[model samples]
Target: MERRIISAGFVQDALAALTRRGLDPAPALAAAGIASGNERVSNLQYGRMWLAITAMIEDEFFGLAARPMRPGSFNLLCQAVLHARTLEHALRRALSFLRVVLDDPAGELLQKDGLAEIVLTDRDRPRLAFAYRAYWLILMGVMCWLVGRRIPLMRVDFACAAPENRSDYHQFFGAPVHFDQPRSRLVFAAHYLSLTPIRSEKALQGFLRAAPANILIRYRHDQGLSARLRARLRATPPEDWPTLDRLAADLRLSPATLRRRLRAEGQSLSAIRDEIRQAQARIMLAEGRLKVAEIAARLGYAEPSAFHRAFLKWTGTSPAAYRTDKQG
Candidate 1:
């Protein structure tokens, strides 16, 4: 997968810790070969800057919390949870270690009603979004690497008001984000907690070597979850798409369980099928080769007229007009 580029504002937030300590971030920025005013930076560049800042302050957390998270503290956390059999056990171990090391913003892992929540308890001082993000990235990043898949977030709530670059939350988490929420928490399907961790000790070493950079950007693979689900839909023609129950049974899950999991990830079976058809229609139209009627039949439409209506609904233009516009 292509690396995700982060906005300059994210860097500014990370540098806030230096500013808090009355320390200049110039040297750290220089170490990372980044400018103070650059509009964006690659994941690697941001990770470099993060390391430089941590070394300078002797705190992995940038001194945002009541106590400084000493260097190698995160490494120990990774080691502590390395042998955990499932995501649930790993998270339990991880949060326990964090509470002992960091004084403020206690973290809790709660699961109920088929959903799991990682809630951060607020203390004396108001928490910055950076602190919230750091805690999340640590847990989330580790969890993804542990399960060998990106656990899609349902929603992320922050206690602090929206920051200047709050949109980055959507780009990073790929979910609806709300600011100034009652408490800061990350939510996802509880079933994911039962997934067995698949990474090895050597893999953990390599992962920590890259640290938050690799964690910041997910390296895509045939890992698990919806990627496999989407791939299954994409492989079969629209007319041959299996029923929900069949698909669920094929994946060894109950139909209701499958539906609930997809819903938690903010997706639906019908919606995914529509997206696939839409994408195929656009590509075929752009090619300017296939007849409109032929394309409609291949997409499982009973008549060209029905396809026309659906096309208009999807793109606000007739298929012929869409083709003509693309051709021109």
Candidate 2:
């Protein structure tokens, strides 16, 4: 099994921090022999770029004479987090902004059943070796400090067996963090979503717009089939829309096999087709040049009425109403 690496977003975040501390990041990048003109700097797919930046920070910025800067680095991140309006908003911002401080490909924060669950997807990796757990701990601690009250954890679930540092985990989270579960997650009450952010949206936007190109490419991977299907829909004409069997064949699987695989992934051929149709319909409606009948024929509908019905199902309104709303 291959080891997935940190994302370029993570590297850019670290560089941003170093810059905040009045340090020139160009020297660090130069030390890593990463050329200024390298497109990878702008591309998000270069996960190793983050690893290189981490090495530089540990070696040059902190140095052997001092302890690792993990604690201090985390402190700065937590300071940013406390500025958010609500804990829910803060978590979303943290997910977007704090990629540099840690990298865990198998982790995600989700809301379900009126609670927030920080889900960890990886089970085979060493628990202590995971960077995101440390980040989460610091975040929880800082959030408590900012709110002037402790947030009780509803439950904790871990994928691995008990670690040697079990006492540390218990003390830090102040919850019964369990182990040997199918998946790891931190469950918390949902009401924390209403807190106002301490930081300005303009400041956050600046960071987002200035995000390194490499980071964008890395994050794009998570957009999943929606992106790929969209690209295909855009590039192909309606007349050339591939049949399910043809698409399955192109993907190197039998039609039945493809349906089974999609089922496992919690998707379906009909859903994908409907999604493509709805997207194309919106684009056509927005363009305003195509007649409704022409659009229906172009979309492979047998009749304009059939197309109207599908459009109504897709948007809860008639196609004419949708176009009128867009014009309005």
TM-scores of the models, in the order given = 0.68, 0.39
Worst 10 contiguous positions by lDDT, candidate 1: 218-227
What is the per-residue lDDT of model 2 for residues 81-151, given as tens digits with 9 covering 90 to 100? 75676777677666544444444324467874345787755434645312434345445544544443344
Q: Which pairs, if any, clash in model 1? A: none
Per-residue accuracy of model 1 over 73-114 as CA lDDT, tens digit each? 989998998899899999999999989898778899987544
Please list the residue runs of candidate 2 whose C-alpha ends up more than 4 Å from where it truly belongs after superposition: 1-10, 23-230, 260-267
Off by over 4 Å in 1: 1-4, 219-328
The CA lDDT at 128 in model 1 is: 81
What is the alpha-carbon lDDT of model 2 when measured against the actual structure? 0.54
Predicted model with the maximum TM-score: 1
CA-RMSD of model 2: 18.8
